[model samples]
Target: MIFGKKRFPGAVADFEKAVRAQDGDAAQEAFARLHRAAAKAGDGELREAGPRLATLLPSVPHGPRAAVAVVIGACVERGADVSACAPGILAGARETFALAADFCARWADTGGGELPDPDDELTEEIIERAGYEPAVGWFTLPQWEMASVAVLNDPAVRRESAGTAELLALVERVAEASDHEFRCLAYALRVLDDEPLVVLHRDTGTGYALRMSGIGDNFQLHTLLAGVLIGGKHLPGQAPSPQEIAVCRDAPGQVETVGSFNLVGPDGTWIFNEGTPTDIPVIDGARLLVLDPPPYRRAWPAGRFFPGMRGDLVLDRVLDAAETAAWFAKVQPAKR
Candidate 1:
């Protein structure tokens, strides 16, 4: 060890030993040691050691991949020319993100964390140009939907530059942190809201088609819910009438076949695509209807994830809930 601290090489060597023995705890400890060492080391020292470090990244467990990438992100942040190490970093990132996608898919019925195919020509092109600012659109997002999700969940990140370093920073922050699954959806929603892709088609007069590219049937319903909630609040004029809200709720079903959405009206519940116009009777003084995602089925669910949760309250609760759930699940046994 150098100066009574485990230096980069020694830390990496310890990680390798942990990996060889398949000891996850030991591997994490070694990676922590390596991270601390990298932090203490200078830019030139990291840049000089880049090649070997990049090569070792893919071999490590997925849990530590972003932590390893953090070193690279920091190097890039500090303006180190990582051109020689970029290829290796990209290759490892592809593998790690794929593993992350699969891991997250296990939590939710529909969200597999959808990373783009790394082998695709367009993906390679984006990665090639990732050294530039425009790389924000494709490389960071398509590579891992979680990055998109993270961007959406955190308004700060969504509003900032979603460049390579920022994307890497998000992955590092979330991967081994907490609320792995919920945060992914929360973050993705923030990204989706800011994303230029969601074209609002007011063709139906009251409703709009939320055409977001990466969003599939799984997310289509949630996207629709988000659209209605967002649109109701920020429709630029008066709050949408109950009739307008009813139409918007039904719109997603016509567009996507997989999921169904509905709104609880003043008179009764109105099922999307199932009821006639007369069945969804209008109320003179009805507020925008509240709908919940499937399986939860909670009545008048206030926000996306919790009840009585307005703007700032919603953000805090959802984030705190997700983080708490993540921590709880880890310590307690699974229940039926």
Candidate 2:
């Protein structure tokens, strides 16, 4: 009971007491004490104290989690300069994110599980929706995907980094934080437009295979979506096409499979594929057509888990819209 504050064994210690306490009052009191302690202590200087403070609060049911989010959100709202508050706010937010990730892993389909799998960290749905399969026999996305998603979802992070001159800084931060090559994210956001992989058969008038390596197993795929431009060079003896999907052999000895893609038309409707085979041929010196990833379908209708959302939940909603899809599919004369 140093200075009227009883330090617990660990973060788990405080959390368990909160969970097991017979009365809500005891838990609330413990949480308030811990939250204040953590906030006042700032960060890094506290040794293991940070985890201990984080664990004591009611993370679920929106009590402590909401409080932490509120505090960080307040810092942003109060015009806290990026130089002063950004690091601590990001640290606090990361702590909260860790807690939430733990909470999510403890529950199974019914929302109770011990912890999220360090392995099997991704779902087939994410893969299909994102338009590229994980490396052979792998699950979850690579580091670059995680970085991209985080940047897209967090408004504060984006607001701070949004600028004309700081593009290189933004890319460097993404590379450092995501454990991926800065060039990878840059290509995805700018030239490639986040389609995972793209294919083209134009430049050399033959099929060209661009292999992606490093960060994990090698993956090869291709696409040209709206506003995305790529040089279509083909492999030897392979003809080029303006409106066709290219199926390529992965590495060696691996069976070739057609990748599912979405062709979003200007109209509200969408075109999708299940990776079934098509008997399309190629011609020389014509337009180039990309095999975009397929449109998303809601496994459980929206508002089931995500409230106020109608239809299905698409990860990249704005970029995935039918208008965007159609524009990408629309044939335009290649810029000379």
TM-score of each candidate structure, all chains considered together: 0.30, 0.24
Model 1 lDDT, residue 87, Cα: 48
Note the Cα lDDT for every prediction shown. 0.39, 0.30
Using lDDT as the measure, which candidate wins?
Answer: 1
TM-score of 2: 0.24
In candidate 1, what are the lDDT values of residues 254-326, reduced to their tens digit? 2212222334333334334322122222222212222323333322211122111111201111123343333
Off by over 4 Å in 1: 1-6, 12-27, 79-81, 96-336
Error of 2 at 78 (Å): 21
